[model samples]
Target: MGFKAALSKVFAWYVNRHLNTVRQNAVALQQKTFSNLIHDAKNTAFGTDHHFDKINSYEDFKKHVPVRDYEELRPYIERVVNGEADVMWPGKPAYLAKTSGTTSGVKYIPISKESMPEHIKAARNALLSYIHETGKADFVDGKMIFLQGSPVLAEKHGVQTGRLSGIVAHHVPGYLQKNRLPSYQTNCIDDWEEKVDAIVKETATQDLRLISGIPPWCQMYFDRLSVVSGGKKIKDIFPNFKLYVHGGVNYEPYRARMEESIGFKIDSIETYPASEGFIAFQDSQKEKGLLLMVDAGIFYEFIPSDEYFNDNPTRINLKDVELGKNYALIMNTNAGLWGYSLGDTVKFVSKNPYKIVVSGRIKHYISAFGEHVIGEEVEQALMGVAAEEGVEVIEFTVAPQVAPTTGELPYHEWFVEFGKEPKDPAAFALKVDKALQQKNIYYFDLIEGNILQPLIVRSLKKDTFINYMRSQGKLGGQNKVPRLSNDRKIADELKEFIV
Candidate 1:
């Protein structure tokens, strides 16, 4: 076998070895991982304050470190930014990933030296897991394009600050750099449009095998490639393209359009990597969820989604999570984040493998008029409608349109940007409305009781979502249009570009 093939085989063996250990006894492996975490950082300031040395069990640790979001951990992160050693982790953070989450805007998440290993290892293992499960490793010898953020980083106090993708780009191993497209200089372009133009010029002729990015941004790149290549599908330019790795947004809505741009159906791997850490990735083709990284230097916890807004919420560990229940994720990682609320929700799909599917964001759901709908539900509904109507939905977002006058019931307003507009726009809207009613009982009840007016669909001009994202200065990386919002914050802004 060739050297690349041998390397692929060895990488697969290594990741699968750990995969088998976790599958054998996930709880035991998690317990051991947690033990190492507390013991390793016990001397750190945050660890000492929490008496990590005295913490001998999960119960002991949970009682001492209360659950907190980025806002709650901001003080410690600020201290780390100000050159404080052993603040959260044992030493100063190597970089701070600056993210503007839908709810928690502008968070500086620390990535410590100790945590960097887990981050890099989890990412490598994600690709390795796909190779192991599918027995496809030829991609190793071909070019791979990671549509990531600007690689140019800035300093915040003594710590480097940039988008997570840019920070990760800096650490791309030397060997893989040979196969990676869009040179570091092109990636350093701060303006997204300019970056995409440069990327297309640099990589349009490469023999690309792997492509990875958020669904919307990837769609943008694919569309541009089609336009630049004289209406040629992506597969025509890069026939070796085999795998599309996606995360940060649900791929369902963009699936048809993406496949159309590529000219063929290709294999896909989904991952759930947040700025805080690399969380999970799809491990099996037969299964539909991502395997939790049981030993990735992170101890996990879950709060039932229903109870998440409660004054006092119950936090359950990995062993206690039930199948098919939405739970907001809380994690204690080696990076010194203890019981940190990741602000995302997920549902356990397999106990034996500890696999889960990301459900939605904590604050990205719509609960207006007692109709609670999440990203998964909205995405499913949109996909169902689009499939039935023979339409291709590029992107969409939903918001409540509260009645301006008395005796008028509130209703849902949908902003749809269509790749292939349905033959009948009115009928398309009706189908979408019916799909939601079928998926959500509360929504059905509200419509039946006249508590909500019929759902309204407003078709948007081409490039509406893109323009909106540009206006917000979040045109690339992990930023995405929130699928559902309680209010019209996003909807109001998107109105300017509406058709």
Candidate 2:
């Protein structure tokens, strides 16, 4: 190892030791975090309205503050947006994270100054933990790229506002400023394609070592690199490329195709970051799940996924959570979002250290006929079969076909874009369907009882998903195609590009 890598190890060692201490004292740390957050925001408008100065204990807080999604909480958030002080946090938020919302258009999540540092620290600590575990820190010296949205910000109600990735771009630590890539001008280009071209022009021959982004965009970059370099694999272009850090989407569907683009495998770390706060990250290459952040400014609550829609769902803390049960993640952050629903569901894989695997979005599912198939189940089933059959899945989504055009029984319709289409498409469909049935008992019963026919795979042309997103004017910058939907909104649009 070089001097820089050696030095990183010493620093990583201390951070890892601290993380271990936090992990071991998870319950105590969370209680302290909760107390600190409540105490800090007690004077804010939200706190005052919710009776923050009232009685003690989680029960008292829960009684005072009912759980709220962005819509339910928007009354106070709107006050903040109108330049009101102490509406959510103690003062106005440092920045407002703009995101698309289903019920309410253009949701703005508050990020207080105190909360912002935790976002930076959790991400940095994830890397440090990796270096400590693997003793691989040489990539720190090489050029790194984070394929993201433009860093340009717009003033919104007296606060800077932009995509979270873009906001983070402006805050890249001084040490990494030199190593981070695609110049500010290139990053600021509003058009994704134009920006990508500029990035490829600048970094095609650089010592690019670490790449970070959502999986789909990174795949697009690799494909662009291949075309520009006369079909050369990404590995050939940046020989020192060592690590891939990704979040915002499950990597299983994109993993095989990504490796093919690279011409080999490379190490990857998965993170669970959201607009509210940085939640968790893969702390060890050997672990199957991301290590949930315990000491971060966010105090967490979990509602059983199956019970989420119930009028009064059960809410519990990390101390009471059980393994393998899916829970809708809730957050009460220093950002001043109180009892806020994150809309994502995650399941615990390990206790003490608290490792969690994101299961699926609470709203993203197929239950048209009572078979509540989730993202995790569908991905596992399709990828399981695809892996065994030597098929490489590019992208896919599932929706229930309640009424078949063929006048047959209703079935699930799968709109898929394939990197490698199976030789026997009929057989491939059967395998994927059977695999899914095995995973979901409800689905199995529906198929066995003739309530639904086997799923139909409608293989789509290349750029099918891209075309759909572009048609909606959501082609890039953290926009993702839903894996499955209760309605036919996405599947109907995808029909335009079907092969």
Candidate 3:
């Protein structure tokens, strides 16, 4: 082997050894992280207000700091934004991750220097682990692309501020900068289509071996490449393409369409990284879950998702989390977010190594008519029926059609854009509806009681979802249409794009 490949093998081996040791002491590592966070922030404004100096255990921590979403935590964050030192973390944060929020509009999440490296390290280590297991390090030598927001940042209160992806763009390690794609000028283009056009122009003929992005944007990239190459498969355009790293959304729903775009399946890694913390990453090709980052600079607590809206939900530590039960993910991080609710839900798939599968978002679900369907159930239902029908789905969303225009019964409306439409659309809808009924008993009872009719699948025109997102100025980056909603806001707007 060449020097670079040999060196990568050695590094991957050492990193894997280090990671095994770290996860083996998961509980102790978490305890250390918790204690360090409290000790570090004891003199900060929020710390003092929450009596952090007196917090000696989880019990004290919980009693002192109640769980809070972004809006509830805004007062303290406002102080931080106004040039106040020691408001959230010590002195000041390195950057403010700007993200869209439901209640707070544009929210600024602090990222201290201490916590920034965890995000970089976890992403690196995920690749190292993959290389160690598969012995595939050649991809490191080829061009790589990560579909992300513009790297150009704006100033907020003397601190740099931008989307989390944009902020991370400023920190791409020096070694890989040579192999990274879509020149800095191209990445800074504000418009998504313009940026993709530049990316396609620059890299269409280059050797691209590794591609990373949320699946939909990657699909957009692939489609652009295909059009440029006269309808060639992605694998034909870049024959060496091997690894696909994705996160921010589940990949299964887009799998069939993406695979068709590529003309074959490829190795993939799923990561659970948020502005709050780098939570987990897929560590093994054989494992079904992403391994939790125990040594990362974050303390984790989980509240049962079912009980999340209750006045007092049961919150438990990593050691106490049970397998297969959904829980709302909470964190106290080095970034000075204490008792912060991520609004995302997850279920522990493995307790020994503390691995988890993202179940759904706490605020994004369908409970209309008492069925309480979740993201996972909807995804799995669609995935199962698609497999059985041999149809390829491009995108879909579920919303309750409560008020039928002509006085028909209420039903779940599925807006689907199919790359390969089912030969029997009604039968396809029936299969998916049945699967959802089996997954959620309440939905089955609602159907049996005649309170709701079978789900109605509205086959939409190609790129209907894309057009809708573009119209809303959310065409790319990490923006995604909600999979399920309790109301008709999205459902009503989708009427303009029906096939």
Candidate 4:
């Protein structure tokens, strides 16, 4: 390996060792907290059945309860909105994390006072882990910039209502909180224009060292920062900036563009942050697989990928998990979400129980034309084609659409943004077609007699997809362009730019 690559590997090994030590300490601390929570839940109105009965062992817990989705919890959310007590958890919730789901409109997920600590601890741990990984903990005491959702707290009555981001921001250390760009109680959504303007004005002279948020929003902020600073790169704005923590969705597609825009290779860390809880984070500087926080105010259960649809899905406790297998994630958080199926899939990368990589979202599977293609399958196929062709893909998306033929079946259309134009697009498409046929028999059969035609690859500009998402009001702040679409609506919407 080259000198830099070898150094990176060595540094990763060192950081991994330290990460394990910290994880062990965190687990012990969390286990005590979890035990006390279980004890408390047993005496509460919501826990008449000895709440610990079902959770005696992780395995037992998985077998007795069916996986639950957000739809099933809508009634409980209604209770919170109406100010009912002991619906999901024991007490009146302190705040709600407002989020938008695919099929559902705005949802106010309950976040109790008791559960706020989990959010804080998880978030703090994520930052600490990043510091440990990059060996930059010494430099982290500088001014840190969090490019997050607005600090506006929604209200129901005369009292201020708490949103997750707002609550967290409010509870941050006084020293750090004082340096925040916007106050926690401000109306961020309604006052976005003014807030953005204020942020530009305030940070125009600060020595900002860290940035945290989704890539799209970060890009927007950086664009503003550039404009205000005479098109200077992030290095010019924060020469000591050492880290970039990003989450929400895969940052792979936007990584190149972001780095180019920023004009520096700032160390990037990926995290799995959901309204329910902070799930996983990359602990080492190497940015290898993420380590799941086992003891963070939640009891985690893994339903084996093979058993994801079993009549009774069996749960595997955190202790019994093996390495390199995918699992449908379920969690019982202190926030009153019990046996909640997160609808996200993950796979273990090591035997150490705390580390796993997010494979994909459960509902992200594509069955266009009835081929039943999944996220992993598609990612693998694309990676394989890129490897064989010696090309690097910057971004890609696939959608199912009906071919305009006399009597043709629907097929998958691919849009690929490459770093450099491929030597031959048709040849690359043929290779991908053959790979899909070999990996998926259903796809192969459909392609043999024209039931499904060969894959079509549309070469697109680097920023085409990002611009498309922005045009649809789905870009910037927490929203991401779908990588795979089942119907033609999003596909048709994007075709204008692809062609």
Question: Which candidate number maximizes lDDT?
Answer: 3
Clashing residue pairs for model 3: none
Per-prediction CA RMSD (Å): 1.8, 1.1, 1.0, 5.7
Model 2 ranges off by over 4 Å: none
Pairs clashing within candidate 4: none
Distance from true position, residue 370, model 2, in Å? 1.6
Error of 3 at 412 (Å): 1.1
lDDT of 3 at 100: 84
The 10-residue segment of model 3 with minimum total lDDT is: 1-10
lDDT of 3 by residue, 25-123 (tens): 999999998999899999998988999999999999989999999888989999988778899889899999988885578888999999999999999
Question: Mind giving the per-residue lDDT tens digits that candidate 1 earns over 368-459?
Answer: 88788888888888889789878888889999988645667788888999878889877777777888889889989998998887787888
Q: After best superposition, candidate 4 residue 367: deviation in angstroms?
A: 2.3
Question: lDDT tens digits, residues 1-499, model 4?
Answer: 3343344445556656655775676556445655655655654444553345456644444444456778876766676667767666777777778776776677677677777776776666666666445545533445667766666676753224644555577677664564455434332644444555666676767867677877766776777889989999888887877778888767765675678777877787788877788788776666468877765677677888657766776676666677877788887777777777787888888655367888776667666666766666677777677766767776677887676566656678888777766698889888887987887778888899688888888888767866777576655456666677676667676677664
Give candidate 3 regions above 4 Å deviation.
none
**Per-model TM values vs. the true structure:** 0.96, 0.98, 0.98, 0.82
TM-score of candidate 3 on Cα atoms, chains taken together: 0.98
Residues 1-499, model 2: lDDT tens digits = 6676788889999998899998899989999999898898889888888888883678898899888899999899999888899888888899989888765778999888988888889889988988999989999989999988889999977899999989888788898898999889999998887878889999999999999999998998999999999999999999999999999999989999999899888999999888899999999998789998888898999999889999999999989999999999999999889999989999999996899999999889888988888999999999999999999899999998898777999999999999899999999999999999999999999999999989999999998887787788777788888998998888888887888
The stretch of ten residues in a row with the least summed lDDT in candidate 1 is 402-411
After TM-score superposition, what is the CA distance of residue 412 in candidate 4 from its true location, in Å? 1.2
